[model samples]
Target: MTSTPRSPHLPLPAAALLLAVLLTACGNQPAVPDWQANAHGAAERATAADLAGNDRVARQEWARARAEVARTGRPELLARVELMRCAVRLASLEGGDCPAFAPLRQDATAQEQAYADYLGGRLAPEQAALLPAAQRAAATGAVAASAMAEMADPLSRLVAAGAAVQAGRATPAVLALASDTAAAQGWSRPLRAWLRLRAEQARAAGDAPLAAQLERQIAIVETAGQPAR
Candidate 1:
């Protein structure tokens, strides 16, 4: 051969630098869209509108929240949150009295309490205890229904009485009806609130002993229902 063999050229560093540039470019590309963020923002705005006593805005936000929760597969949690949202709207409508809000809050609270009891292993015993009565009532057909209707009449009377009590025009009959309803409902928060109102009415009407008795009943119910704290 006339010439010496040529040395081979190595391009490893150049190839590595090219790969690094490509990777960096890919990493710097635009991010995907964030639907959740937008939905949440809409929810916040809706909440603000609700707080400002705008029912229309509140409803709009509820729809958005529902849609987002459906997409996210968290409908149960979202439903509870929606209850709080509704509660806020109701409070705004009622001039800041939570008790004056719609019954949705009470129903939601009952559900939440039931769930908590289940999680804490406290619901089984209660359910077991109630099963016998439930089964007996179920077997009674129209009789059970009639009894329930009869029971409901008293509750309705109590509700009416509670209204009168709030207006400072309650009588002994009204107080008795309210007390009975409260007891029958197992001192549920809503019922307890009614009982408190009745007690207030009693106090306003110069029946301190009755008011004290109602207060004691309320305390007992509250203590019994309270989660271990």
Candidate 2:
């Protein structure tokens, strides 16, 4: 007599029980990590402060946010926080310390490195003053051009606009882009004020045309939020 072959499948009930066990197990997974939550929370607070015209508080919050993730030992998150800090510093007319980001640069991706280069270039007059003058100028010019063309971050864009003005690369197109951004983003108040001050200084130094152009750009940006007629 031939022996009966055993069925290769589990009974329907057993299959259903297995699935339920899996579903329950997945439902009980761990919550989000503390570092991630803290970092996000800090960033939101910083953004809110920036929008409220509180520059110092915004920068402080941004720095705190970066520190939150720095404790996690995650390079990508750390790089992102560094970039945010750099953006805040740049927008405030203080620029950031280039050397402060050297550690982040080590593990950064190509895009992140580009951002660092741009910030360094933008702050070249102060941060990179020790470099040979010719080398500094070349690097600054190259990074400025690349950043203006490639940067997508809104805060970074504002910073780039201010940098362009400072470097005498303030073409109409550049000014137009900066003006439009400043008008569209209410958080740009501090940046706009800084640009106005820069323009005034230029005027006092006898660059009347440059000053007038910058002032026009500032006027356009400052009036950008007016109610429609």
Report, for every candidate in turn, its global Cα lDDT versus the true structure. 0.42, 0.54
TM for candidate 1 is 0.31
Q: Write the per-residue lDDT of candidate 2 for residues 27-127, one digit (tens) a residue.
A: 44655456656666677677667645667887787777778777877775576566655555555545544566688677765545555655545443444
Residue 97, model 2, lDDT: 48
- Report the C-alpha lDDT of model 1 over 57-117, residue by residue, as the tens digit: 7678767765665564544434444433433332222221222123333433344333222
Candidate 2 wrong stretches, greater than 4 Å: 1-31, 51-56, 122-156, 163-168, 194-198, 201-229
TM-score attained by model 2:
0.54
Name every residue pair that clashes in candidate 1: none
- Model 2, residue 202: C-alpha shift (Å): 7.1
TM-score of each: 0.31, 0.54
Candidate 1 residue spans exceeding 4 A from truth: 1-155, 162-169, 227-229
